[model samples]
Target: MAVSLFYRTGSNAKEWSGTFEELERKQAKLRRASQRILERHQTQDGLSEDDVQHDLKQQQKLDKSAEKITEYLATHQEKTGIKGKPVKSNITDPDSAKMITSKGTVQGYNGIAINDDKHQIILQAQTWGSVGEQQTLVPVITQLKQQLDKLTKQKQPNEHTIKFTADSGFNSEANLEFMAQSGFDSYIDDNQFRKRNPLFKESETYETEQEKRRLKRSKGRPRLFTSDDFHYDEATQTCRCPAGNQMWRSGVNVNSYSQKYTRFCGYLKDCKVCPLQHQFMRKPSIKTGRQVQFKNDESRQKLSYGDKMKVKIDSPIGRRQYGKRLGAIEPVFGNITVNKGINKFTLRGQEKVNTQWKMYCLVHNIEKLRNSLH
Candidate 1:
C-alpha cells in the first residue's frame, strides 16, 4: 500500500498585542500580590483580629478587578486588519480564514491520500485541523484497514493485510506498536537519521580500516540477551527473554494507539542487578525506582521490530522510496486548497471538524475517480 499524510498551516492573524515586557510586568504584579497574602497569613500570633476582615475585603476586590481585566483582554486583544490590534468583528470562530503555507494552503479541508496496491487509485483520504503529520499515521492506518475490508467484500474473496508507506514524520514508538498490533506491512522511512550523508563523514574512512584489523581477532563472548532474544507471544500472554527466562504478567495495563497491553517483568530478579542494567532498564529514571516495575515482553518485542524497521527505513534506497509520500499525499490537499478555494473552517468543535474533514476526503475521492475514468 502507498501512504501519504496531510497537514494544515496555522492561521497568521494578529490576535494579541502589547510589548513582551509589559505583559511580564502584569504577571509580576499578580505574583507579588499573591505572595503578600501568604506572608500576612504567616505572621506571628495568627492574623490580627482587625487585619483579617480588612485583608479579606482587599483580596476579594483585587481578584474581581483582575478577572475583569482578563476578560477584557480576551475579548478585545487585536483587530485582524491592524498590525497589533484585535479584530473588532463578532466572529470569534478560528476556522474562517483560508489556510496558507510556504507550500500553499488548502481552501477548505487539509488532507492526505493513499493508494492501495490492487489498483493505483485512492484507497484512503483524511483531513485534519493540525499541521503536524506525525499524529496522522494511526488514523490513516485505521481508515486504510476499513477501506480495504470494504473493498475485499465487494471484489476479492481472499483476506489480505494491507501495506502502508510513509516518511519519517510518522515514526514514533507508539506508531510502530500500532503497526505491529494491526499486523500491517509498512515501509515507513526513519526520519531521525535521514539527513546524514555517511560518504562525507571522516569517521567512515577511519572505521573501514579499523574494522579490517578487528576482524583478525577472535570474537568476544555473546551477549546474555539482546532485545531480540525477548519474544512477545500475544496468544499465551507471556514474554520469553533471550536467556530462557519467562517475563510473566505484572499489574496495570497501558492503553496506547487503541491497543491494550498488560506489562510483564522477569521473575528472575538476579538478572535485574546485572551490569547490563542500562540495556535492560533503557531509561535511567526507571532504574532508580523499585527494582521490579511493570515490563511487557510484547512491548519489548515490538520495540525490537521497530528498531529493524528503522534500519530499513534509514537505508538510501528506503529514503528514496519513502520520499514518494510527500508527492502521493500532498496534491490531494492541493486540489482542495487551491482548486476548491476552501481556506478557513466554517465549523467549530472536533466532531464538526472531523465531519468537515470526511466531506473533503469524499470530494477528493470523487476527483480521483473522475480523473481515472477520463
Candidate 2:
C-alpha cells in the first residue's frame, strides 16, 4: 500500500527532520560506496586516466547530494518529528535546477486530511507532491482504515465497518466501486452525472426557436423525445405522449432524497412515424441542454438519487459536516512544514521515498496523540 506524507503549503515548504550527526553519517556512507565502486573499476597496473575521470564524476554527484543534505539541515533547526521555530525566506525566489527532482519538475504539495466519520477526528494526514485530490483518496483511506482497526480493538464491538465522507474531489466511478467492494460506506458525489429536470429553463426563447428550425430541417432521422412528448398521469401512474401513444413503464426506483420516479421509453417505430419524428431524429442543437431520455439502467437510477444527493450536500447540516474536513486534516501538514521545517526529501528512488513518507506519517500520528493528551 502507498503511504501518505502530510504537509502544509506546497512541496517546497514540506518539512522533514534530522540531526547534523545523521547528515554526517549519510555523507560518510555515500563516500564509502563511491570509493568501493571506483576501486572495483580500476586496472591491475593501478588506474587509467579514463577510469580516474569517471570516478571523479561519480564522486562529484555523491558530493552534491551530501551538500544538499547539509544545507537543508542548517536552514531548518527543528529536531526530527518536532515542530520548529519559523524563519522568513524569499518566497518568490525560484528553486534552481539542482533542487529539481528526477521528474525534472517541482509542483504543488497538496495536503490531505482523512477523518473518522463518527467522531470527526483526523485519522490520517499526509501531503502529496502532486496536485488534485483523486490520486490521494485510496492511500489516505487505507491509512485511516488501519488506524481505525487499531482503535476498534480497544473500543466498542458494535463499531466494525468504516464509513468515509468526502467531497466531489474523491468522487469517481472507479473510487465508488472500490469503496463499495471494500465493505466501506461512502458519500462520494457522482460528479459526472447531471440530473434532468424539466422545470429548469436553460435555453433562451430565440435559441429554442433556432433549435426547433434546425431539427425541422433534418427529417426522416431518429427523432428525439422532449419532456413534452411524455405525459405523466400521476393518478393512474401511466405516461402518454402528445401523439396519443402510450409509454412502456420500467418499474420505479427510489432516490436518495426520497423521490421515486417511474421510467418510460417509446418504441422506435412509433417515434419515427409520429409528427415529432423530425424533432427527435435531429441531435439537439442546444449546446448545453440536458437530454430527456434515460440512457441506461444505472443512469435512470442516478436521475432521481443524484439530484437528491446534490441537494442534501448543499444543505445547512451537510455544510457543517463538510466544514470539519479542512480542520481535521490540514494541521497534520502545518506541523510537518511550518513547525518541523522539512522542505525537500533527502532520499532518491521511489522505494526510499516511500519509506521516508511512512516515517513522516508515524511521526505525525505520534504528535497528534501527544497533543490530545494535553
Candidate 3:
C-alpha cells in the first residue's frame, strides 16, 4: 500500500509508448494474425460468433484511432510539437490516461471527490480519463448539484452558502470563474500558493544535484539561484547572468519534454574570481560558471478570473478555509487507498473505474454513519 501497484495483465508502460507509425504497424500485424486464426477456425466450421464480434469491436477501435491520428497530422505536420504529442494508445484500455503518480508513470484514470467539511462525507466521487485534475472541477461540481437536487427532492438554493476548498490541482481561470458564480464560499490555491506564503520562506528545495551538494557545503545557507535568476533575450539571442553579466551560449537545442531551450553559461574569466559565484554554483572542479536555459516567450492573456480568485484566496479567511481542505478531503482518499486497500484499481476504462470509486466512497460514508451511530 505504500507504493503504487500496476496490474500488468492487460498493458504496461512499454505497450503504451509507441508512436503513430509503430501503432499502425503493430495494429496491422495483429489484425493479419488474428484474421489467419479466425480463417483457420472458420475452415473447420468451428468459429464462434461471439469471438468474431469481439474481434470486430477491437478492430473498430483501432480504425477510430487511425482516423483521429490522420486528422491530427492534417493540421499539425510535426509529430513532436508542443501542442500535441505522438498518440499513445492503450489497446487494453483506450480511455485511460498516462498518469504520473507519487510512485511513477501509471496507465490509469484519475479519481476525484468532493467532501463536506463537517462530516468529511463525500458528496460526489468520479474518475476522469485525463491526467490533469484541472479539467475535472467543473464537471464534479455540476454533477454534485444534480445529486443534491435528487437527495433533497428539490433544487438546492442558489445561495446555499456551502464552503468549497480545493487544492492547486483544481485551480484554473475557467474553474475559478465557475467557483465565483457558484454562490458558494470557495478557496482554491494556485500552484505557487505555498511559495507565495511568507511562512514557507525558510523551506528548502534541492531541485538539482548542485543544490544538494551546495546545501551540504553551505550548511543551511539560503537557497542558491536557479533558471529564474537569469534572463534570456529572444530578439538579441543573448542571455544575462544573475549579476547582470553577459553569458556565452554554451549549448543549443537542450530538449526538455516537448519544449526546447537554449543553454547559456557564465564565462570562466568572469566567474572564477566573481564575488557571486554561489549564484551560479556548480562543481568545484568545473571551469565553467553557472549555466541556465530558457525558451522563446509566449504572449500572456489577461485572466480576470485568476486575478480575482488570487485576491480571494490570499485573504486571511482564505488561508483558514483552504487549510481545512487537507483535513476534510485527503482523509477520505487515504481511507480508501490505504485502509480499504483500493490504491490501485482492479478495473480498466473510465466508466467501470468511476463506478468502482463511487462504491468505495459509499463504503466510506457508511463507515462514517456507523461510527456516528456507535
Which number leads on lDDT?
3
TM-score against truth, every candidate = 0.48, 0.39, 0.56
Residue-wise lDDT of candidate 2 within 222-282, one digit each (tens)? Answer: 2344554343444465654433345566556635355554566655545655444444445
Please rank every candidate by lDDT, starting with the best. Answer: 3, 1, 2
> Which numbered prediction scores highest in TM-score against the true structure?
3
Q: How close is candidate 2 to the true structure, as a TM-score?
A: 0.39
Return model 2's CA RMSD, one decimal: 17.5
How many steric overlaps does candidate 1 have?
Answer: 15
User: All candidates: CA RMSD in angstroms?
Assistant: 17.1, 17.5, 17.0
> Alpha carbon lDDT of residue 48, candidate 2?
83
What's the lDDT of the predicted structure labeled candidate 3?
A: 0.63
State how far residue 254 of model 3 sits from its true place (Å). Answer: 57
* Per-residue lDDT of 2 in model 3: 8
lDDT of 1 by residue, 26-102 (tens): 54576578668767777754777788878777777666555544654566443243134332321223332344456
lDDT of 3 at 65: 60
